[model samples]
Target chain A: MTSHHETDIALDPELMAYVDGRLEPAKIAALEARLAHDSDAREAVAKWRHFDNLLNSYGRQADELPHSLKIAALERELASKLKKQHWRAIMLGTGLRRIAAGLVLFVAGWGSHAAYTTGGNMLASASHPYFVAPTLAGHAAFKLAAYQGAEFDGDNITSALDWMSQKMQHKIESPKLERLGYRVESARLIEVDDRPVAVFYYRNAENERVTVSVTPKWTEHGNYALRVVDLDDGVMAYWSSDQLHYTVVANDNRGAITTLAAAVQQ
Target chain B: MGLKSELHEHIGSLRRYALVLTRDPVAADDLVQETLVKAIAKAETFQRGSDLRPWLFRILHNTHISALRREKTRADAAPDLPEPIANDCQHTQLELKQVLSALDQLPEAQRNPIILIALREMSYAEAARSLDVPLGTFMSRLGRGREALRQIVQGVGRGKLSILKRKGDSA
Candidate 1:
C-alpha cells in the first residue's frame, strides 16, 4: 500500500502492482496516463513489459523438456521402493519368530522349573548351568523315536523349522532324523537371549515321548558342552555343535538316549 | 496423486529457474533432481494447503549454491566461462555464450533475484516468501539484479576487450 513516488532510487512496490494490473482502477488510469505522456514513466513501463515477456519465454522453454528424464527418475524411485518393501518383509518374519519363541518359553516354565519338565522322563541336573531335562513322557517318546518304530504327531514342525531356519540363518529338517529311528511329533520354537530354539517331540512304542531340541549356537552361546541327567527311569542328553545346540530326553532304560544321540550324530 | 504429484507439476518452473541460474541444462537438471529428491524424502515437512512452488524453488536455490561451492573445490571442474576463446568474434553463438558466462559470474544475491523475476515470473511477494525474506528486500534485490545485468550486457555489447577483461576478473 506504500506510494510509488519515493524520493530515492529505491524500487516502488506500487510499480509491481501497476505491472501486474492489481492497482485500483483510478490509480491504474492515472499511472497509465502518466506512462503515456512522461518519457521516464514510458521507459519504466516498457522495461517492465519486456521483463515480463522474457519471464514468459523462459517458462515456456522450461516446460518443453524431453520425456526421458522424468521416466528415469520415476524408475529409480520405484526400485528403491521395492527394495524397502523387501527389507520390511524380512524384518517382520524375524520379529514373528522371536515373539513365537518367547511365548513358548514363557508357557514351558510358567514361573517354575518343576513345571518345565513334568511327567518325569529325565529331570534336569540342578548343578548344570545350561539345560533343564525332560519328563517321563518326554523320555518314552524319545526312546521309541530312537528305535525307528515310533509314531508321533508331527504338527507344526514344518512351520517351526521354516521360521527357525530363516531366523537362525541355518537349515533344520525333522524328516532327516527319521533315518535315526526318530520322528518328530510337535516342534515348537523357543527363545533364549532373543535367539530361536527348535524343540522337536518324538514318541516311541514304549509310550516314552522324548524331546530333542536344536538351536543356533550363536542363538545359545558357549563351547561344546554335554550334560547327562538320569532321573526316575528316564535319561536326558544335552549337547551342542558349532552351528546348533541340542538336547535329547528319553526313558524306558539307561543309555537309550545316548544311542539315539549317536544315531543323530551319524 | 497427492502432494507429490501436485509438486511435480511445478518442475517445469523449477527447471526454467535452474536453467537461468546455472545456464547449463545438465547442471540445471542435476539441481532440479536434487531439489525434488530432497522435497519428496522430507515431504512431511510441507505444511498443509500451502503453495508448493516457492518451497521447491527455495530448495533448488539452496542446492545450486551448495553444488557451486563443491564444484569450486573440485579439481578440473570447468569454469563457468567457455574455453578456447574462439578467435572468431563475428560468430553470434560465441557472443551468446559470453553473455551466459557473464550471467553466471554475477553474485548469487544479484543473479538469483534477476532469475526469479525475469525467468520464473515470480511476484515480489512470492519470491520473498520463497526466499524467506521481506517483500521490500525482494524488490531491492530484483532492482539491483536488473541494474547489474544491464551494466554487464551493456559492457559486453560495446567491445570485446572490455567485456573479456571483466570476464577474466570476474571468473
Candidate 2:
C-alpha cells in the first residue's frame, strides 16, 4: 500500500497489482489513464511485466520427477508407517504373546547375525563379484580428489556429523579417528550413482588425508562385514551396519585404515 | 480425499518450489521427500478445512531452511538461484542463465519474496502469510528484488543498460 513519489513519477504498489492483474477494473482504468501521460510509469510497467513473464517461463521449465524416485518415495513412506504399526501391534499383545514375540525376535536377531558373519562374505563374492570393487574404487577416487582440494562445507567433527545426519536422514556417530592420529577437517554430501553419500574428511599431523563416506544401505542383500580393497596410492575399506553403508578411504597405511574401519563399525 | 491423499496432490508444486530453492535436482527430490514425510508425521496438527497448499509450502520452507542451517552452507540458507536449463535456443538459454545468476546474488529474504510473488504467482496476502511476514514487509522486499532483477537483466550487455540508467536517474 506504500507509494514512492519522486520527480513527478510515482513508483507505487499499483504497478505490481496492475502487472499481476489483481486490481479492480475501475482502479485499472484509473491507472491506465494516468499511465497514458506518464512515460516513466509506462516504462516501469513494461519492465515489471517482462520480469513477470520471465519468471512464469522459468517456473514452467520445472522438470518432472522421475517415476522411479516417486515410486521409491511412496514405498519408503508406506513401509515406514507399516513398521510403526507392526511395533505397536506387538507391544499391545497379551503378556504370554509378548513374551513369545520377544523370544522370536531375539532368535531372529541372533540367527541373522550368525548367518551374516558366517556366509555373508561368500554370498557377496559369488553374487556381487563385480559390485564392491569398482564402486568402492570410483567412490574412493572421487573422495581423494575432493579431499586433496579440501572441498568440504564444515570444519571440525561436531558440525560435520550434524550435517551428515541431516542430509542422510540418519544420525552419524563420529568414530575415534583422533585416536588413530587423524583429525577431522571437514565434511560434505556427495552423490555416487544416484545414491546420496555423506563424506567426512580428516587430516593428520603428517598431513595425511582420509575420507569416510556414509550412506544408507542401498543393496538389500549385502552384509555389514568389513571388506578392503587396495588402491594405487592408498587403501579403501567398506562396511555396513544395521542402517548404513560406510567406506573409508585413507593413505597407503593398511593397518591404520583397517583400524579406522573397525572403529567406525563398532 | 483424506488429508494424506490430498497431500499427495501437492507433490508437483512442492517439487518445483524445491528445485528452485535447492538448485540441484537430487537435492530437490530429497527435499520434497523430507517435506512429505514431515507433513504426514505432523498431519494431526493440521487444522481441518484450512488451505493446504500454503501450509504445505510453509513446511517445505522450514524444512529447507533447517537443512541449510545444519549444513551451514549458506549464511541465511535461503534458496540459491538455480543454474539455467539447457535449451536448444542458445541466445534465450544464455539470457536465462544470466538472470538466474543475478538472482543468486540476492539474499535469501529478498529472493524468496520475488520467487513466491513472481515465479509462483501467489497473491501478496497468501505469499506473505506463507513466509510469515507482514504484507508491508513483503511488498518492500518484492520491490527491491524486482529492481535488482531489472538492473541485472538490463546489465547483461544486451544494449539495454541505458534504459535502466535513465530509469535509475529518474527514480
Candidate 3:
C-alpha cells in the first residue's frame, strides 16, 4: 500500500525514467499526459535530458584519442629530453616491483631515450607526433628500444606472447616477421609510466635491429590510422586495432620494420 | 573480440568518469591507470560475455574508495573529499565547465549515477550495479541528484545545492 507522499516522491524518478527512455511505452504516454498538466515535472525531464546531452557531448569531444591528436612536430629533441627525464624518474622509483622477473637487473629502462626521428618532408603525407614518441604509446615503444639486451623474460616467441597475454588485457600475438628475414631475438617486460608492456627485440642476419612493443590504450575506437615518424637514425610506425596499440621502431629502416608492421597488421 | 578487449573498449569512458569523480586530472589519470591494471590483472575473475562496462566501473569505483581510505590513513587531515579541485580546467571545453562544476557540488553517491548513465551511456540498472546499490536507492539518488544538478548548473541559481544523504548512502 503506497501512500500519497511515497507516490509524490516516486513521481520524479518516474519522470526521470521517462527522460532516459527506460519507462515502458505505456507508462510514457500516461506520464506525458500527467506532465502536460504538471509544469514542474516537464521541466525536470527537460533538465535531465539536457544535462545528459551536455555530458555526452563533452565526453565525445574532450577525451583525446591517440589517433586524433597526432599533430606534426618539427622538433623531436624536446620530446626526447622529456622522455628521458620521465622514464629516468620512473626507473629511479621502480624498486624491484615485478610480477614476474627472474632476472636481477631492474635497470631503469628510462635511460634509453627515443631516437630523434621527426623529419619535415617525411611527414608531408604521414602524421607526425605532437610530442614525438613521448605519449604513453610512443614512450612504450621507444623506452623498449633502449632496453635491448635486458634479460629475455621469455626464452622463445610462444612463451613471450603467452606471458604478455597473461599479464595484459590485450592478447598480444607474436608477429611472424621471420618470413621477411626478421626473427625474434628475445622478449622482455619493461615498465613505462608504472604500467607493464611487453617488448620484443627482433634482429635479422644483417645485424639490423627492429623493436616492437604493444600497449593497451583507452580508446573510443580501435581504428587509429597508421602514423609514422622518421628518426634521424630510424623510423617509428604505430597503429591500433581492437584494443591493442602497436609500435614498430627500427634502428635501421631496411624495410624490415615495414615488413613487420604489415605482418603485425595481418 | 575476447574478454579483455571488451573491457578495453570502456577505457575512455572510465577515464572520463574518473576525471568527473576525482576532478583532479592527475588523480583521475592515476585512477584510470590503476583501474586498467587491476582489470587486466584480474581478468579471470570476470565472467565471460557479461557486460564488462559495469564490472570495469565497479573496479574503478572500489579503487577510488580504497584510495580515499588510504589517503585518510596517510594524512593528518584529509581534504574534504567532495570539494572540487581549484579549477585550472584546461581538459574540457570552456562551455561545459558549467556542468562539470555543477557535478562537483554533488556527493559521490549522487554524482556516480549521473556520470554513469549520462556520460558513459550506461543503463540505470547497470549504473546501480556499478555503485553496488539497490535499484530503488539508485533511482532516489538519481532523481534528487539530477534535480540538484539542474538547479546549480548555469543560470539556474547561485544558491548552493545540498541534498541530504538518505541514512546509509553516505558517499
Candidate 4:
C-alpha cells in the first residue's frame, strides 16, 4: 500500500484509512500526532470528510428523485421476464442468456448466404448409443433461441460464423447447409453449464426453425447414426466431431431431418 | 430473504450507483433494469450464501462498461453527458451536482474506483474484484481519482453555476 502519493496531494491515504476505520494501530498514534500540528493535513482530512459527507447527503436527497415509477415499471418488466424465463426453465428451455449489459439489444444486421449442400449420406448406419448431454437433449426438446442481446459481426454469413468462431475461441464456420435449402437465420451464444454454447438458428422453405447447437467437448457416443432424437415436442438429429458436439433440433420431420443431417455433416 | 427479494433489495443501491456512473436517470435505470434482467436470467450462477451486493455490482458495472464500448462503435454515438434527468430535478443539490460534475470529468477508469469506494462504499478489495482489476491498479486509480476530484473542487471554488451551463460546456 502506498504511504503517500508524491505526485498528487489529494486526500492522504493515511487519513482516508483513518476515517474509514482502517488505519493500523502503529500509524494511528503518529497520524494523530501529526494531525495535532499540521493544519494543512487537517484541512485535507476535513476535505475528505466533506467529500464523503456531501455524497452521503446527496444519496439521501437522490432518494427524492421520482424513481419509483420507473423502478416499478422495471420491476414489473423484470417480473414478467422472470416469469417467462422461469416457465422456460420448466419447459427445459435455455434458462439463462449470460451477458447482461445495460445497452440496447444490439441486433446485428447480416444478410443470409447459402452454405455447402452435400448429397452424400453419412448417417454411419452403426448407431453409437445416442450419447449426448442431457442438457443438449433438453435443448433439442424445446425451440432453440438465439440470445437476443447477441452482438454479431454480421456483414455476411461467413463473417458472422467467423465472429462466433472467434467469440467461442473454437473454430466455428458456417454449418454448410445453405445448399440444403436452409438459409442462415441468426447465430448467437447461450450459456450451458456456465459455458457459452454457440447456437445457429436457420429457417427452411417451410419456415421451420432449425437450430444447430455447437457445444464444446466431445461425448464418446457422439459418432452415432443420424437418428431422430426422441422428443415429444420436435425432431432432432445429432452428430459430433473432434471436440465439438453438434445437435440440430427442428420442428421438421424424419425425412427432412435425414437430408438435413446428411447435409450438415458436409 | 429469497433470491428474488434479495435481488430486489439492491435495486435502490443499483439505481443510485447507475446515476453516479451515467449521470442520467434514464440511463441509470436502464443499467439497473439490465442488471436485474441479467441477474434473474442467470440467477443460478449466484450461489445462495455468497455476498449479493458485490455480485450485483459486478453485473451493473460490467453492463455499464460494455454498453459504453458498444456505443463507441456506433456512427451516432451519444455525447459524454446526456443532459441528465436530474436537470428536471428541482431538488438538484448544487454541491452534489458539483461533485457529480467533478466525477464526470474523470475518465471512466478513475471515475469507477471513486464511485465504487467513495459512493457505493465498497471495500477496496471487493471493488477491485468486482471491477476485475488487480488491487494495485484499483488503488492507483483510487489515488488518482481522489486527487482529480480534489482539483476539480478547488478549481471551481464552490460557486453557484447553472448545471445547464455545465451540460452545455461539457457537451
Candidate 5:
C-alpha cells in the first residue's frame, strides 16, 4: 500500500478510536479482525500509538505554577473583589449614592466628547503637555473615524510636511506613496506626548484609507525591532529609523502600508 | 465559594495551557492573569451549572488569538532578521526542545486542538466544546496538526531545523 493509503487509514476515526481504546467491545473485535488481515491498518495503529505516547510524555512536562505568580494573582483578585464590594456599599449609601451616579453620567458624557467632535473628527484639538499615547487600537478607532469624516484633499500634504519640519527641527522626507497605488488625501499635525506627529492620509483605488504618521526624533527603547498593534478598525505598524519614528495605520490591509513605510525608510 | 475562589482553583491548569501556548513564562503569566480578570468580570455570563474549565479555556483562547494576530502583523512589517535557535543544549533537552519547537510551529487553529486533545488529554467532545467548534472540524484540525508535527519532528534531526524558521514563516 502507498503512503497515501497508510495516511488515510491512520486518519480513519474508527481506527483512531480503536487505538485510543474508545471503541465498543464488538467494534473492537471487528477492528481487530481487520487488523489481523490488513498489514497497512496494523502499521497505522502502531504509528498512532507511538504518536500518542510521545504526546503523553510531553504532557507530563507541563510546567508547575510558580509561587510568586500564584500569590500575586490571588492577592490581586482579592483586592479587586474588595474594591468592587466597597464601591457597591458606597453606591447603596444615602446621599453619596445620587452624587456618585451623577458623576458617572458626567464622566460618560465627557468621554464621548473626547472621543469625537461635533463633525465626527477626533478631538486632536489641543496638545496635552503630558499625554500618554493611546494603544494602537485606540489610535485606529480615532483615526478611522477622522478619516471617514474628513474630506480628502492632497493639497495639504506640503503644508503638513512643512509644519512637521518646523516643529520637529528636522526635514521629513515624503515617500512616493502614489507608487503603491495610494493617492495622498489630507494631512494634519497632531501632538502625542507633546511631540509633533505629522499625519498623512491616503486613499487607494479601492477607496481603502490609510494613515501614515511620522514622529521625528522619536525612538523606542524596547528590544523589539518592529511593533505591530491590531485595533478594532485597523492595524498599526511602528518602526523607528535613525531620524524618525513611522507608524503605518490601515484597515486590515497592512501589507500595502508596510510597503509604503519601506519606501519612506529608503 | 466566591467566583474569585473558584477561579483560583483552575490557576495551575490555566498556567500550563498558557505556557504551552506561549513558550514564554512571562507571557504565560500575563495571559493567565488576563484570563482570570476577564473571567471574574464576565462571571454573570457563565451559566451557574456549566463546567468552569471550558469557559476559562475559551476566554484564554480568544485572548491568545488576539495577541498572535498583533504579533503576526508586527513580524510582517519589521525588517530585522530572525535570531537563530541556540544549540548549546544536551541531547535529551534538545530532543524535548525539538518536539516543543515543532508544536510551536503549528498554526494556532491546528495547534490549539492538538494541545487540547493530545497533550491535555481532553476528549474529542470536550475539546470541541471548549474551542466552540463542531466535532468533525475539531477532529480534522487535530489530525492535520498531528500529521504536520510528526513530519516536522521526524524530518529534522537534532539541531537542524531552526525554531526561528517556523515562527518567522508564521508571519
Candidate 6:
C-alpha cells in the first residue's frame, strides 16, 4: 500500500465538504480513516484546518469591534440630516415671501451655496454655515426626526409650540413680532444643532415667509448672531438672539426682514 | 415591536459587519448610520415577513460600496486598527488580513453566501432565505468562495516560498 497517496493534489468535492463540516457521519469517518495512515491526506486536512482557523479567527475578532466609532458616525449623519431637514422646511414652504428674504440672507451670508429645485419648491442648502443650527435643542429635534416615531407637522404655530413646550418640559415661543407685518404661519418642533427647537414659519401680507426657530441655548454667553445670504431668486435673513434664531427669507423684500429683525429685538 | 425597534436590535451586528467591510471605525459607523437612515426613511416600503437583517445588510453593503467607489481607496489601505480594536485581531493578524482581502476580491454572489454562512453562522437553508437564492446557488457560491480563498492563500504562500528561495540562492 502506498504510504503517501499522490493520485491527485486537488481537493475533491467530497473532501471539500468534509473540510466545510458538511460531510455526513459515515463520510467523515472514511475521511478520518484515510487521514489516519496517509501523510498527504493528513497534510491536506492540516491545511484545511489552518484555513478554517484563520477565517474563524478573523470573525472571532468581530466581538471586539468598537461600538463608539459607529455611534459617532451616527451622530454625524443625524446632524447632516437635521441640517437638510431645516433647509427642506424652508425650501418646501408654500412659496412664502419671507422665504425670499431668508434666501437673501443666506446668499449674502454664505458666499457660495447650492440651491436645489425640487418639485416647485426651492430648497437652500442647510449645510451652509448660517442655515446650520447651533443650539442643542435644534440638533436634538433633528436627530429625533431621524429616528422613527417623530413626525414633523407644522400646521399651527401657537398650538404646536404650546404642545411641544409642554411635552418637552421647555418653554419655546416664537419671536415677539407685534410690530412686523409678518405673523407666524406655523411652527413645528424640530431638531437643529443637536437640540430640540421650534421652527416658526412667518408670513407677510404679500405671502413672503419668514421662520423664527427657537431652541434651548447651551452655548457660553448665549449670544445672538445673524447670517444673511443673497440668492438669485431672493434674500435669506438669519438672526439668532439669546432665546432663538429667526430666519426670514424673501425674494424682493430686504426691508421686511430688517424691519422684522429690529422689531423682534425691541 | 415595530420594524424600527427590530432593526435597532441589529445595530451592533451592522456595526460589526461594517467594521469588517470598511476596516475603519469612522467609515464603518458612517456605513451603519447611512444604512439606518435609509432603512428608516423607506421602512414603509419594506415588505412584511421579510428578513430585516439581510435588507439592512444590503443597504449597508451598498452604502459602503458607493462610498468606496467615490473615495477610490480601500478602508484596509488606511492605517490599520484604531485604538479600540487595535488588540482585537492582532494575534492572527496575517491570516485575518489574508481572509479579508480574499473576501474583498470575491464577487458579490460568492461573497454574500460566504458572509452569510461564515459570519452570520446561518445554515445553508437560512442563508438561502437571506440571499433570496436557491439552495444550490448558495452552496455553489459558498464552495466558490472557499476555493477562491484557498487559491489566494496558497498563491501568497508560494510567493513567500519563492522569496525565501531567492534569499537562500543569494546567501
Which candidate has the highest lDDT of all? 2
Pairwise lDDT winner, candidates 3 and 6: 3
lDDT of each: 0.56, 0.61, 0.59, 0.59, 0.59, 0.55
Instruction: Look at candidate 2 and tell me the lDDT of residue B69.
Output: 75
The prediction achieving the highest TM-score against the true structure is: 2
Candidates ranked, most accurate by DockQ first: 1, 3, 6, 4, 2, 5
Report the lDDT tens digits of candidate 2 across residue range B1-171. 433454455666676777777766678788888877786686555554466777777888889879977977744334233333333454455555566666777777777777776665467887887788898988877777766676666665254334434555766
Listing candidates in order, what is each one's chain A TM-score? 0.42, 0.43, 0.43, 0.41, 0.42, 0.39
Q: DockQ: which candidate is best? A: 1
- Model 3 sits at an interface RMSD, in angstroms, of 11.6
For candidate 6, what is the lDDT?
Answer: 0.55
Residue lDDT tens for model 6, B1-171: 433345455666676666666666666677777887786565555554566677666677677667877878664653232222223344356456656676677776776665555554545676676666787777767766666665666666566445545655766
For candidate 5, what is the lDDT? 0.59
Q: Find the 10 residues in a row with the least total lDDT in model 3 chain A.
A: A99-108
TM-score, candidate 6, is 0.43
lDDT per residue, candidate 3, A104-215, as tens digits? 1111121233233456333233354322233333333434455332335325667667666776766777766665456787776665554556667776654666777766
User: What stretches of model 1 exceed 4 Å from their correct place?
Assistant: A1-10, A19-25, A69-266, B1-5, B73-102, B159-171
In terms of lDDT, the poorest run of 10 residues in model 5 chain B is B73-82
Model 4 ranges with Cα > 4 A deviation: A1-13, A24-29, A66-266, B1-5, B70-92, B158-171
- What local lDDT score does residue A12 receive in model 2, on the 0 to 100 scale? 63
DockQ of 3: 0.12
Candidate 6 docking quality: incorrect, acceptable, medium or high:
incorrect
Tell how far residue B88 is off in model 2, in angstroms: 9.6
Model 6 CA RMSD to the hidden true structure, in angstroms: 17.0
Q: What does candidate 5's lDDT look like per residue over B1-171, in tens digits?
A: 443455565565667677667765677788887877776687545554466678778888898888887777422222222244443334345555555667666787887886776554457887788798999988777766666666676665423445645644775
DockQ for the candidates, in order? 0.13, 0.09, 0.12, 0.09, 0.06, 0.10
Q: What pairs collide in candidate 3?
A: A117-A230, A117-A231
TM-score of each: 0.45, 0.47, 0.44, 0.46, 0.45, 0.43
Those runs of model 6 whose alpha carbons end farther than 4 Å from true positions after fitting are: A1-27, A30-49, A69-266, B1-9, B71-91, B129-132, B161-171
The candidate, 2 or 4, that scores higher on TM-score is 2
lDDT of 3 at B124: 81
What TM value does model 2 have? 0.47
